[model samples]
Target: MKTIHLIVHGHIQGVGFRYFAQTTAQSKKVTGWVKNQEDGTVEAVAQGTENQLQSFVHTLRSGNRYARVEEIKVSEADQDQTYAGFKIIR
Candidate 1:
């Protein structure tokens, strides 16, 4: 399994981006948490197979109709962290 940290930029906040990400992650069988950052960015950490993670990233870039995703910064996450399911961190 692979874990990745993401900082999603653009018109994401207050647009249900966290819900979108949680749905996508659940569909892909990825376990993680997504939350809105203080800097008007969306932050997330997802764990899954490489293919699953890649697909997740792709979907995030596309975003939901209400959200216009400009960029997503991805990087390897701490391997020790694990989650039972996908969630939106309020």
Candidate 2:
């Protein structure tokens, strides 16, 4: 399994980006938690197989109808971290 920490930039906040990430991650069977950052970005940590993570990233790029994702900064995260489900952190 692989874990990645990503920061999504652009028109993400106030646009249901966290819920979008949560739904997409769950659909891809990825375990993660997504939240809105104070800097107007969306941050998430996802754990899954390589394919699953890739697909999840792709979906995140597309975003919801209201979100215009400009960029996503991704990096390898602690592989030891695990989550039971995808969540939208308040």
Candidate 3:
């Protein structure tokens, strides 16, 4: 399994990005959480198989129609962090 933490910048907040991420993650069978940051960025942590994570990353890059993602900072994450499913954190 693989896990990734991503900080997405640009027109990401208030653009249904969290829901988009949740749906995309579920489709890829990944478990994660998406949350909005005070700095006007979107943060997420996804865990799944390497293939699943790769596909999820692609979806993140593409984003939803309302989101104009300018940058996504990705880093290795602990696979031990678990979630029942993808969720939008407040």
TM-scores vs. true structure, each candidate:
0.98, 0.97, 0.94
Q: Note each model's CA RMSD in angstroms.
A: 0.5, 0.7, 1.0
What overall lDDT goes with each candidate model?
0.96, 0.93, 0.90
Q: For candidate 3, which ten residues in a row score worst on lDDT?
A: 78-87
Count clashing residue pairs in model 1. 0
**Per-residue lDDT for 1-90 in model 1, tens only?**
999999999999999999999999999999999999999999999999999999999999999999999999999998897899998999
When sorted by lDDT, best at the front, the candidate numbers are 1, 2, 3
Instruction: Please list the residue runs of candidate 2 whose C-alpha ends up more than 4 Å from where it truly belongs after superposition.
Output: none
Better of 2 and 3 by lDDT: 2
Best by lDDT: 1
lDDT of 3: 0.90
Q: Which stretches of candidate 1 lie over 4 Å from their true place?
A: none
Q: Predictions ranked by TM-score, top down?
A: 1, 2, 3
Count of clashes, each model: 0, 0, 0
